[model samples]
Target: MDATADASTRKPAAFIGRRLLSLLYDLLPVVALWFLAAVPFVLLDVAVSGDVRHNIGPFSLLQWLLWLACWIVTGLYATVSWRRGGQTLGMRPWRLRVVADDGGAPTHGALWRRYAVGMVSLLVAGVGFWWAWIDRERLTWHDRASGTRIVRMSKRN
Candidate 1:
């Protein structure tokens, strides 16, 4: 078999450690995005409220909207990166790539599903990620829901 074929056929690596590391790396850019997204919301609040507010109020409408915007912006970053290259900036360092369970690039719909499920998984204190430890195939909740998997790539010769 060709080198590419051999690499593609390998089972996904045990991923929890690498996935967490990648998330830590990805956090930097996502935080930057959150700050950028908050800019307009902050400005609008300042204009309307006429107060120099350092932060949005707890449970307020504007605060919720800002949270939603950050979620969307983060999703855009993740989905676009996955769609274009199957690897986010974070995943690159770990040699991880997201792919369909069938070993092909996932469709846009699947990618979005993956993101949404992943968000829920994170919100639940990453029970989904922990589940991979016991899952027979080492699949996370998002992986099962979205029909996708993250595979670690072999080193290039």
Candidate 2:
């Protein structure tokens, strides 16, 4: 009997719990960023027309750009952090890690594929995100598509 190997094979439930916590942590920063971006439009309306009811067409373009930028920032954050550190800021706080199916740092290609698929999942009524809840293995569609897995990291051995 290989005791050490057996111990290492146990599932990481704590890590998953931590990962969920980290998602909440990350959400705070993302929402803050969204709010900051929205301020420009608010200010533009006040400064240009001095009327609350007035609509600024140029500001609308800026708002759209801000929205797009937010998505790009989020995707890049997830991809770069997951590939380099095995988790994002959110995942780290929760002590969750992401790895390739074979248990290694994901390649850039794999990260991008995961992000792209994740976007598609969001477009498709968020079925991909919800997949994790129903999946026996707790994997989302993007995770399966990218051959990635999210594991909970534990403090105690």
Candidate 3:
């Protein structure tokens, strides 16, 4: 068990602004991975033809494939981070940690669920994250649905 796992009783749910900021920070790595994910498509395109650009149109196969790749990469990054340490690179600097209902590191299944639900929340204009402000415990929709919560780390004396 990680030391931060025992924080529910001592630490509070993270503020929405903090969560948003951390997400913004996390996007840097995500975008980098996205670019990496595009490499194969570019390589294949170049090998088959002369151009290496992927046209992102409504009916573009390359676009769909790239989207899938990006989703898988994002899920891997989040799930691994959540299951291994309960924090991502962004969450680390912000002192945010994700824990299960029992305040332990989330299970793999829970982490995946959280990632999927989080995507849904984001797709819906972040209504789920906003739900935290009104939720009595300040848990987001994904957190509640996935049986997990993100908490602010307490200061260590």
Candidate 4:
């Protein structure tokens, strides 16, 4: 395949504004997943301790584990969606699709890297995402680091 030809036909890279909109849309599912994942952990704790604790103690191992579980579950949701169709439920509404920088389907590793860096980007108050404004290509840290990019697909007629 001619890389240049494929590049020429690919959709334009999604801008930060569009990306943010899709993220906001995605938050709904992610929050639901977190709630679903937390249920089992909380239930098990109640079974083992014979106490109906409403919340995990802060800085405790259970709390840490819960957080880790939530993170992994969220990652699975994102990476699998991107791998299957390049669009998560959130991206679909916005016509945004994640693709390899070379205009092909992104690899599993690349998708995970993208997810990981995206997590870091969030932890740092979205500095990595904001970097896109200054980037020559308007790419985020995750986009550049993972060799992936989100593109805005044109509407179908």
Candidate 5:
């Protein structure tokens, strides 16, 4: 019997399984960041005005800017890490990694494109994420658009 045959036959990580684990790993930190950003407004409303309604000052332009900043930070973290290391904090925990479909590290351009297109996918009701479940090759819409794939790293490899 070929020694490598058994190793080769092991199933790769499932899309849903990896995604679920990644979400679990990411949820706490992401939520914490969001809460930290929102807390100042809540405190201002309570401290100066004695009312929570006006805490963020009627959701003005500055408020929007803050929201955008938070999103950008999160997106940048995900994109840069994925491109540079092939894995985000969550993906690393699950031994799943992202790579170009051609089996190389993703270029910066590809990473940006993937991140931007991912927003579109969410706006359309997460069709991009769901794409992995139904895709013949198990590629998400963002993966397809960016020419990338997420694969499980074998223990030995």
Candidate 6:
């Protein structure tokens, strides 16, 4: 094998820490989005039930519906960012880009797949993230499943 060619294909090293930081950064926008998404839910609740929040103990149909709405909103945010630029608001400052496993811009289906699997990854206490430490290419579960990976971006001249 050509060593230079192999080295060029090797996964870049700046991924692990930046992944966590980018998530933290992304949370700001996701939270804002959730807040915005909540408005209609709350408005509907008030219109129907005369209360802003449900009285049921945390797991009502309304609660689940609201949760699903927030989840979809979050997914939409990620999918759009990855599809359009391979970088979310959070990914920008960290100089990271999410690309297909083949190093191309992620396709629409691939981006949505990443978002769905990413939701699972988050629900599972981030076992997906820990998987990176053990993966030869340092790919997280979502990274592997979605055929996507985060890459360290280089500065322009």
RMSD of each: 3.8, 5.2, 4.3, 2.1, 6.0, 2.6
Q: Write the per-residue lDDT of candidate 5 for residues 6-118, one digit (tens) a residue.
A: 43653343476687578579767777777877776567557876875664654675578667867876777778789778887887778888787656788888887887887
lDDT of 2 by residue, 36-76 (tens): 76677678767877988776565577567766877877777
* TM-score to true structure, per model: 0.90, 0.68, 0.88, 0.91, 0.74, 0.87
- Per-residue lDDT of model 6, residues 61-99, tens digit only: 777888999999999999998888888999888888888
Quote model 5's TM-score. Answer: 0.74
Off by over 4 Å in 6: 1-13, 52-57
For residues 39-108, write the lDDT of model 3, one tens digit per residue: 8877876776666564455667877888899999999999998888889999988889998877677788
Candidate 1 wrong stretches, greater than 4 Å: 1-10
Best by lDDT: 4
Query: Which portions of model 5 miss their true places by more than 4 Å?
Result: 1-14, 35-53
Which lDDT tens digits does candidate 1 get at residues 50-119?
Answer: 8885567888999999989999999999999999999999999899899898788999999999999999
- TM-score: the better of candidates 3 and 5: 3
| Pairwise lDDT winner, candidates 3 and 6 | 3
Cα lDDT of all candidates, in order? 0.89, 0.73, 0.86, 0.91, 0.74, 0.82
> In model 4, which runs have C-alpha deviations exceeding 4 angstroms?
1-11
Model 1, position 29: C-alpha lDDT score? 95
Minimum summed lDDT over a 10-residue window in model 5 is located at: 5-14
Error of 1 at 93 (Å): 0.5
